[model samples]
Target: MVSKKQRLASVDALRGFDMFWIIGGEALFLPLFALTGWSVFHFGHGQMQHTQWHGFSFYDLIFPLFIFLSGVTLGLANKSLRGLPVSDRAPVYRKAVKRLFLLILLGVVYNHGWGSGIPADLGEVRYASVLARIGFAWFFAAMIVWHCTLRTQSVIAVTILLGYWLLQTLFGNLTPEGSVNAWVDQHVLPGITYQNRAYDPEGVLSTIPAIANALGGVFAGRWLAHHSGDHKAILKGLFMAATVSLLAGFLWHWVYPVNKELWTSSFVLITCGCCLLLLGIFYLVVDVWHWKRFTYIFSVIGCNAILVYLGTSLVNWQYSSKSLFGGIAAALPQQAAGTFLIACGVILLQWLVLRFLYKRGIFISP
Candidate 1:
């Protein structure tokens, strides 16, 4: 079995890899797209950026995947919790709750401020978001793990997903266009509508499926903890995930539309499938094949993911780069240079923070 410390490296590496995209994936790619003169028509739409009403995208996968990984990490961290006395478990549970609240609070601060030119409006700021969803999911998933056996938790997860599908289809009101999207948004959340009277990425109804995403990770984590050394177990997980994803995508497409914004059942399954596939690859390559050095770079960012995420949110590292690289961007005619410079600057700033945290042994966790 892998030691807890060794498992931490894998989890951190995965977390860092996921956040790298969240922080600047689009910015990094936009410059390339500009240089290629690709039609902005397809790229400009929020669907390309975020999902429309009910669809999937590369962007939509990031947040949920992170949450899923969080569940896996929590399982790995708390594997020994089962052996501990009730007195010992209480403190751990309290700490987990505290961390969840702290993550939600930080997410609010990030959404509201970060010193961007955009005016700070707490009232208008979105109360619910990707981070908030993750926090809630993590808290709930942890509670399930703490209280129930792995078998029972798995049953509960499946029940929630099925129940949510039924509720949305039968109970939800239809929109003017005869869509359940708006109806669920309005009625499910009640007074807490979307931030701009538009849509809520972390809406009430969508959270049901989101919980499944986290629980999927919990299942994976429990499996990992118990069968870390069994090569066949990893293969079994990968195969099972792929099968579930395909079936869910095919079946749910008939009704829910596989929308990432809605986080429909199909979307959750597909994304979780992708996540499982990726995790399997990492496990095979790093753990089984023993690819150590290359994984370190991604692992470093993973180790201090929360710090870099919050720091990037709060501080405009672009300003610091503008002092040096911004002038260089000015020399170029098109916006490409400016975009590239900003992207590079953000990457460097993130790396620097990660490096500093690594040196100081400071890691922020939720």
Candidate 2:
């Protein structure tokens, strides 16, 4: 068996697997339906995109999965920190605060930077971002784990989800212009909404429920860490929790609807369910069955996911792919095949870059 560090491989692999879609791999499927003209490809391609409103899709699950994974890691991180003397806690707290602001700063630059003319375009830029949401939600969840027991943390998560549901149901109008979400963004944030027009998918009020998603991840991490020895027990509990979460989400969906943009309570439950199920499968395979070799590629990407993601955005891998391999892809007869080839080449190029870093034992992380 591997050491304590190796135990984290499953988590890292799972995280990388999720990041695959975000890092251009999802584009690989866009043209697949065109080439095959099969119902399966068409259905999958549709699921790959976000639903316009009030529905579930595979694409909708990616962001929340990141939040959930952070929560899981936080449980492990907090447990280690708890062992330190009280005097040592302050520095860790300070570091976390620094990391928080750094993430917020990065989010700011990502939305409005030198490319967008900096401060001149800041007023119209979408300030709220996926990174900002992850930072905020994970920061709060980390703080909560430092002080609260597992039971208390779980209670807090449930309360947030249920409370948010009640509030939205009572006051939410469920319209683009009239919904409480849009009203708050337009009223409080003004032009800072996504597209600098109306509402942000990762708006302020919606983050309250998002915190619950992270908390659910914390619970998963805690359970896994606690049962690290009894493999059978760990699998059983994970599967059971996944089932319960799935059932609760669908039951609540009738009233609240699983809306990703809103990050609805039901959406939280369902996505967490999917993450749990995925993690359970990964754990059983990599950790129990000892199928470690196949997951190494994912582990490489997951080790520095944040850095690679930011790098992709700043470097504009799309431009690189177009410049370097565009002709190669263009040779294909089917446009769908051509598009899929471009996406494949791009992702493969990214993997090669990441692989080089892995071989050199270099990783950029925050």
What tens-digit string does per-residue lDDT give for candidate 1 at 74-111?
A: 67754446667889888878887888788878777767
For candidate 2, the TM-score is 0.92
Model 2 stretches astray by more than 4 angstroms = 1-7, 78-86, 114-122
Reference-based TM-score of each model: 0.84, 0.92
Candidate 2 whole-model C-alpha lDDT, 0 to 1:
0.80
Please write out the lDDT profile of model 2 over residues 46-114, one tens digit for every residue: 778997889899989888998899888876554545567889888878878877787777876666543
lDDT of 2 at 258: 88
Clashes of 2: 0
lDDT of 2 at 109: 66
